[model samples]
Target: MQSFLSKIKDFNNKHRKIAPFIIWIEIILIFLASIMKNICRHYKILLAVVVVLIVIGISARHLASVESKTPEEGSVVAASEEMSVVEEALQEATVEASNEASGEESLINVDSAVSETSMENVDSAVSETSLENADAAASLESTASLYVDSGISEFIKAHTEAVGWIKFEDDLISYPIMQAEDNSKYAIEDADGNDSETGAIFLDYRSSADFSDSNTIIYGHNMRDRSMFGALKNYKEDLGFLDDHKYFQIITPEGSGRYMLFAFMDVPKNSYIYDVCGDNTSRMREFLDTIEYKTYIDTGIEPTVDDKIITLSTCTQKDDLFFVMFAVKVDD
Candidate 1:
């Protein structure tokens, strides 16, 4: 030991500059080894906390992004503008009717020239009102068409898997629905294929992409942040909620249509309702009966075997339970 210590001191004295660097390297290695030992001892709990923080942070950031992009006030303004146009047309019609009534009352005593002038005024008002109403209708039609084409096209451009948009009336269930090669693709990924705990609303891998199937099934995560399909659980809380929000819209590239809520229930994760390709009418009816039996609310709208239906499903708090909403497509 004395001989080894003497050699080490002799080497340090000889290579002073390089020796200090070697000493620092040894010290760093020892410090890093100590840290590694501590980390290994408490890794499980630390990992859980880190995962939780990451999820919360990601959820917070995603929600903020969604809020920033949503044009709540803009939609209100546009709706108000549409209402104002209609109201103005109605008010003008009322005024013109009053003028006509006054003109008719005076016709018994007025001269021919005055009568002719009043008739001309009334005709002009009618024509002007007609033109305004026509213009307003055209404007509304154009806006709707633009929304159908441009909005869907833009969404498709963002994510090729995005087949359409689904929205529940008076709820936060509005989201773009995507379809991938497999259902698992979007389970942990968003529509853009980005990692997200709040996965994209997705059509069942076995379902028809055009929603032409007898029963189409869609899935989403029940994120704690009230995003994705989290608000769907609200239906189970209040039967009146189902009544108030009895319908939802599913907009596709081909056209826009609506679905009326018929039933919502919770079932085992492997319930037969997930079978999108089943075509047996009697079996389908039996399945529908089971769903209605388990429903939280009675929508009074029973679906026949020939009727097309859609089911929106998500996981519940129970590991084995899943919540589902069933609706039938209504003619627009």
Candidate 2:
């Protein structure tokens, strides 16, 4: 008996991450077993039916979570391929910036040369300049090209509703974000346009699709299988989780936004926190004050009206309860 107990302890220690799930399953089984032994024999069949239904529910939830782990059936390219494309886009931007800088230098040199030339030779010096150089100077208006993430581009090709991608560094919160005419569509539909209870992470319809608004709000299901925004609860459960995991990235065609978690809290479904995309500075200040007041933990970082805010919202266990995670664009 001592050796058997030691083995069980060792197993629990080795699988500490899933120990809670294992313990819950064990508790349910033990309770069911005890009831089976004590309940009248006439009710045994009914209990068996209930057990089967519970198992089916658990299985279905697990299956749905696993299915959303990857992008819809070939909708997204492989990681390596996506990385190469990003690298290429970055290289192109760098080269363009360098070339534009060079063009400006050339124009400066030409102007100086013309200035030094005698008045009689001024027209000839300007005329001698190549048409290509003139065009390059005019084209210097834009030094950088807009880079869209290859993954986002591919997903958009498959489904036009795909607007951007959201990822939490060193976490399981990476997914393509979807948008529709209304927020209700993606709430019940997957990125691939299939119906799913664990719907795709999506931006609020009222907010700008490019994330140009003063405040952008995103929504995802607080799934039981830890998919979508399910893990966001950790911020409220353990404030220490924010020490290392406070930063997340919002990748868009305009640019990639690096945001730092500032606050998280549970609020009513119709909380003023949902009043996003406002341009009023005084109202924004009031919004910031309200956020500071309602947040569960103090991260010591306060966002100003000038800084763009992003909110990740999910439903809690209660119908009227909602959990929200707020972040500021630290990269800007």
Candidate 3:
């Protein structure tokens, strides 16, 4: 303890020539510099302290001689020393006041410097989230495009444990439970099902890969009140909606694919919508043409029988009344 105190004494004597204002300025400047580094969470408090210190320093200084000599000596000698001390103090204070206050003004602290960066971050987060959703949607749309294969059943069962099913007449579309996607099998019945829009007979239908052909169809209600397929109606027009809802992905253990939106329109239900018989080739060709001509907005993708198509059918209540959207598979 004695040694430490002696060291401090010696240090103080060595620094005695330093002006008091200068010493305080250096210490505060060092503190401010540290706060500046982590200012993201404490900028306001540090900035306030720095401002207060500056104001106090400015008002508290007393003009006095560096050393007082005998009054008997020439008075000019005392005046000169005082003038020198004042100049030295002022110069030292200025240096300590601005220590570490330089460099980049910080991107978040200044709107002019960092607004674009923040916007970019928001855009990136939204874009990433959108990408995740798009990937899920793309997977869904891809499934719609496929002709279900046997291997796909295992894939579906393994990945999509959470499944929701709906029956509108003879059609059903199964999906995961949560807002995004899941692999579990859940229940979704039609308004006319066991519970009249609820499900007393929620059944888990295995993938048609075992018995159904590559092409399968599912239909649901497009209630005017916007329950099942109501959200799909917006695709019938051009809007930023496409920006949010483009492409679909249908994933199964067998395969996963990216799908592009190709058709949007109302069609007659009894138009023999599900006839994939001997006339399938010509029928498919005709179907493709009709959908191409009917798309609300062209997504720039052409359809071929080589490409499996997934048709999302819903009720429209119009003359033809089948609200349908077609999507074709792209990547697996």
Candidate 4:
């Protein structure tokens, strides 16, 4: 005990700057020791006091750690809500002060720096959210373009003029339709805009791309290899083919359309059926009448001016002759 007291005295004298704190701790230790010695006979009471002091110290440290932690990013909105709660607390405090002081008003001060920082954080969050939304929308559009029908997607990627696709339900004909400033480009060029004898099927330059016109014309070559519109000749050879294979699907970027075969016959290159795509209602009536008069076999389906018609045209062996098939928008 004497040697320990000598060491403590030496430490206090060596570090004079912290000597007062050391002396205070020493005094507290002595006081506790005196109490412990006096209460040594009551062992249960002494143990309970020590445990209580340890618990209080641990709780104080835990509370300080919680209070010292900084808020995370995106927590500004939550912090703003907490600020509202703080304002409510201050209002309550003011009310209590008034009640205690017989209606005397109490001034409450809020830091301007804290309010400005919160506003800036809110603005930053909104800007970041908007940028994220824009990036997501761009990604969705790119993904959708990637997911287009593989054949059509390749055609468009290779040739910008490629417009849509035509498919018969019975698998008679399937081809990509191209459009240009004029109809003759596709008549000699393939879907990839390369020069080929078996040229691509193409839409009329004068008609609306969405097929909203009263009459729309799509032309393809009747190849001997049975590609392109070569299978269309099957309907003419056996009129019975129309009984089951009447519907053809036209798929565009906008949507798809199912058309039922209503007429098929040979027409001149300058036929009036080609002129019905415009806004002239009288011409459309004449066109329908001509179709009824000139169709090869009566399918019992007569289309009116209110309905839309799509015409598939191909060249015959003769120079001036063209085989044509007329289908009305049956699905509409």
List the global CA lDDT of all models: 0.69, 0.68, 0.45, 0.69
- Give stretches of model 1 more than 4 Å off: 1-149, 276-282
Tens-place lDDT per residue, model 2, 293-316, is 988888889888888989898876
Model 4: ten consecutive residues of lowest lDDT = 119-128
Better of 2 and 3 by TM-score: 2
Worst 10-residue lDDT window for candidate 3 reads 121-130
State TM-scores per candidate: 0.54, 0.54, 0.38, 0.53
Sequence-dependent TM-score of model 2: 0.54
**Clash totals for all models, in order?**
0, 0, 26, 0
TM-score of 1: 0.54
Per-residue lDDT tens digits for candidate 4, residues 17-63, read 98789799999999999987888878898899999999999999999
Per-residue error for 248 in candidate 4, Å, reads: 0.7
- Superposed Cα deviation of residue 121, candidate 3 (Å): 50
- What lDDT would candidate 2 get against the real structure? 0.68
Query: Can you write out model 1's per-residue Cα lDDT over 1-332, one digit (the tens) per residue?
Result: 99999999998788987977888999999999999999999999899999999999999999999989877898979987768646544544454465476544112212332222122221111112223333432343344345454677677776788888887766456677889888787776666576544556889888877888888888877643346676775676666777678888888887777899888888888777776453434568787788778887776778887888888888764557788889899965
